[model samples]
Structures are given as structure tokens and as C-alpha cells.
Target: MTITELAKQWQTVIHHKPPIEKDPTSNDLLILIPGNPGLVNFYICYLDLIQQQFPNFEILCISHAGCDPNSYELFKFYGLKDQIVSKYEIIKKFVMDNEYSTKYNLYFLSHSVGCYINQRMVKLLLDDMSLVSHVDIKYVGLICPTIKDISKSVSGVRITKLFNYTPIITVLSILSSVLTRLLSDNYLLGIIEHYHIIKKPALVDFVSQLNYTNSTLGALNIVSKSHIVKQVLTLACEEMKLINEEKDINDWFFHDLGSKVKVWVYFADSDHWVNDKTRDELIKDYYDEDNHNNIRFELGKSDDGITHSFCIDKSVEFARITTNAIRRLN
Candidate 1:
């Protein structure tokens, strides 16, 4: 879809509209937040699917400014023109202001880098008294959250810091793109076919994993252009600076300062992006699993032993049912 069409669809799905006027009869509110400075299209598309399934719920999206001209140009370069993180904050503030006035169970479906942004927003809402009483944020659905240390997830992401050079990777990337494009029309056709398969809630995640891997190779080419590379570089630098400012990463991330929020941890059995042992360790260290008072950790597992991208797995039907069961808590 074109950028304008995507934005319009996003606004329709996220913002409170005439047809979707905040209904008092609705039992729950669904917030669909996307990851990174890019991915506006993916966020909206997923939200559209969920909105259809849960029409009564209010589905809102929070987009980060990582894809703007001054921010991250990854998406913009790919044709997503407007980078509007400011609009997301406005919606969040609105939710906060009236959070106490209404009573609705809250659900958050976040993807990729969006998971980090949602975590921060959830933290903020938990801290704010005005919003805490109005809604019960019962469940959070995360799709392949970016938990893998970049150094380990992708080969040279970390090494870039040490080398401060982009020649080798850049040349390889450009050459590869040329070769792939020249090989045959089959290459492009294959990509198009894969793109369609990814739309299914079951296949969405696996496709995402493949795309992420492919994109990393393509990303090297962008590094050759200072303006393009600056986006990733600046974000990385700022992220590190933020980490240094904080005493601990888990403390910064998993703090349950909000109203009785239960968490639904979704993962594929074979997901390489999410290190199962490490994630389990983090969960054990950060959250007191024994404390049933506020948190309930419902893990989504693939019976067939699937890999990291479990978001759109065919087995997600089970996962969604499990998620809905969590929502039925209060």
C-alpha cells in the first residue's frame, strides 16, 4: 500500500472515531503498538486484523520517531513519508487524562522494537495515578521482541563499533543486491509470494524473522551513505547513553509499577531471536513468578518446536485463546 493509504488506515484503527466512539458497553480496549522508528505499515496491518476480530475494543497504536528524516530514515527511504511519533504521545496523554473516567480491560499487542516502546509506555501509565484506576491492562502480546543482544543476533552489528568502517559490508551488500536482482525475475516473484504468506497471523512472525535476516544484509548498503547510516548510528549511540544513565536494564524494563498487570510471554520454540534460556533467566530474575497477586506469566509454546517468530504461527489460535483466558482474569 502507498504511504498515504497506510497512514489513513492507521489513523482509522488507532484514533477514536465516530463509528468507533469509545463505547461504554465494550468490555476491553486493545492497544496495538509497533516497534522501531519504522514499521508503520506492519503495525497498522496487524491492528486491522485484530480490530476485525475484536470490534468492540479500542485499538490504538504508538509509533516511534525512529523513521523520520532527522530520526531514522529506514522506512522513509522505503517510501513511508511521515514520521509521527508526536501523534502517538498525544494519544497516550489522552488515554491518561481519561483513563480514570472509564472502566475497561486493557490489552496490548506489540511487535519487534515496539515492545520496548510499549514497555516504557506501560511503565509510565503504571506510574500515573490518573490512568491506573480507569483501565486494567490485563494482557500484553509481544511478537518477536528485540531482546537478543544486537551483537549476537546479527554478525557485524557490534563489530561496526570497533571498526568504524563500512567499506567491506557496503560493497558486499551492493554487489549482492545487484546479483539478486539480476539472477532472475524469480527472485522478485519469490519475495512477493513470501510477502503475502506473511499476512496470516500464523505466518506473520516466521516471515518477519526471515525478513529481518535479509534486511540486515541490505542494511549494509545504507551504511555507505552517511545520511542513511547516521540514523542507525545515532539511535545506537543514544540507546547506549540511556543504558549508561540507568542503573540496570531489567529494572528499567520489567518494573511493575502499574495496576495489577498480568503478562503473557509469547515465544516460538525455535525462535533464535529470543534466547529461551536467557529470556527465562531474565523473567526469573526480574519478576517474582510466585507473586500471583499482580502478574501471571502465560508462555506460548509451539507444539511442533517452531523457531523464534511465533507471532503468526498457525498455532497462534492456541496462543490467542490462552491470551483471551488471561484477559478473563478480572
Candidate 2:
């Protein structure tokens, strides 16, 4: 299937079917939750990598409510708590619809703010007496997590400042939508700042899907869906407002520690969307290389060139990194 087709398919609201009941690995369920602008489209390449690396593992990717393309039929917006609840309900249904078993182990793969949702959902599920004894949470993988004090992040600070001018942003989004219809075929702007006669940036260098043709299409999608633009901005504002506080805000910092679940974290050396100070402190306090090493943290090398949005440029490489981490679990 084409990359665009696969991404569109992933955006569906239906949960993926459980692994083949007879397969030995059927008991293992891996769910990927993407960050804000939680469209599953951005992570399609990464998902393909994981599936290729671990064909036996059944995977489900969840897009935040209102991010699905089909959901555009109706105009609705969801906030942070709504996302957490929606994800939890989806997982619950996935579990219940399949054969119930105590042998099942749940695994979570998350990116950006999805990391925040993963932590809360894990805690919430564990707290429930109904499923508490029925299922086990085995592993959690966080890529460039934004789980704590997001308001303090570089981008968070900048975006939060923009929140005060939401009316202006909203108006611009509406204008962009109107202009998008007139510009879909050729998206280049008549700008002297750019040296190239280029219509699109060199997205092919990082990711093939970022080429001139694809990027023009992407721009059209962004502009045509003004609601999505507004939703993304709204979500960012909500994130800055609510995704604050230290690690223990929900008493989740210490929950599902080394003994209960194995957690792996990979972060860029420099990320505008990350609260570096908070991430460093969490690593120092919670990471243990020796015994009780439930959480393993990897800080990127400064020269490695991976960024917060690694999926676009390094999906294969990052997928290899993650699959390797999971394989090493004892």
C-alpha cells in the first residue's frame, strides 16, 4: 500500500484486531499513541519500521479525537483529559472485545505529549480493580517525551505567549483556508528571502514524503483544514496550561517503576519542545543502570543530528533503536 493510503487507514477510529489468538505472542499488545496534532499520518513510516522489525507483535496506533480525517465531518474539539479518557476507553474495548486473559501484557509506545497520556492511562488502568488483576503492563517506550512542566519548554514558552492572541491566530487560519483553495496546485510563495526558485523545501533529503509534490499536498491539507489548525493551537494552549508541574503531579512519577514495568526513553540532545532541566532531573532521580533498572534513559549525542521530530527523518534508524531496546529487556 502507498504511504498515504496506510496513513489514512491508521486514522480510522476502529481499534486493530488482537493478534492471532493461537500465536504465542498474541498475549502481547503494543499500542502507539502519537503526540499533539495527534494525526497518525506523521508516524506511518515509524509504524512500518516497527511492524517489519517485529512482525509477530500486534500493534495499534491511536489518533487523538478530532485528529482523524473522517472526524472532520463534524466540528468537535477535545482537550487533554478528554484525550486520556478516550484512549483509555479504546484500550479497554480492545481488551474486552478480545478474549480475556490474565496472561496478557500491555505495552505502550508514545511520542511527545502522548508520553503524558501513556503515564496517566497506565496509572488509571492499574488503579481499576476490574483490570488490575487481569492484565499486566510490561513496557513503556517514550520518544522525546513532554510529560512534565511543558509550559517551561522553549517552544512551550513561545507558543504559550501566542495563546494570548488566539483571536488573531484563528482569523489567520480562516484566511489561510480560503487561500489554500486557490494555491493547492502550486504552493510556492513569491519570496526573495529564498535563493532557490523552489516551490517546496528539500523535504526529500530528510524524508521522501517531504518532497515537493508531497509537501505541496501537506500544505494544502494544513490550510484547507482550518479547524485542525485551530485544534492544534488550542491543544497546545491546553498543554501549556495543564501539562505543568513536576513529575509527581499525578503521583505517577513513581508508579509502575522498575519492578512493575520496563520503561525506555530516548530524547534529543537539544529539543525546543523539551524542558531540558526537568528531563535531566528525572533521569538523574529515576534512572538506574544497575539493579531495579526499570527505566532506561538515552540522551542523544549533540552531533547525532536527531531531533524531536525524528520520525520524519530517521524512522528506520529510530525504529532500530527502539526495537533493539525492547529486545534487550530481561
Which prediction has the highest TM-score against the true structure? 2
The models' CA-based lDDT, in order, is 0.46, 0.68
Worst 10 residues of 1 by lDDT: 75-84
* Model number with the top lDDT: 2
RMSD of 1: 8.0
Q: Which ten residues in a row have the lowest lDDT in candidate 2?
A: 189-198
Residues 1-330, candidate 2: write the lDDT tens digits: 433343343333433534433455447778898887676655666766666666656678777766664444545567877778777777765665556454567888999999888888877787777776556788888889998888888998888877775575578678766775665534433221143322433444544444333333333444466667766677888888887765574345444355567878888999999988988877777766563467778888888767887754566567778888888763
Q: How well is each residue in 127-147 modelled by candidate 1, as lDDT tens digits?
A: 667655566667765555554
**What is the Cα-based lDDT of residue 59 in candidate 1?**
61
> Which regions of candidate 1 deviate over 4 angstroms?
1-27, 43-53, 66-88, 93-105, 126-138, 147-150, 153-191, 194-249, 252-255, 287-289, 298-307, 310-322, 328-330
- In order of appearance, the predictions have TM-scores of 0.57, 0.81
Clashes of each: 11, 1
lDDT, residue 75, candidate 1:
28
- Candidate 2 lDDT score at position 252: 53
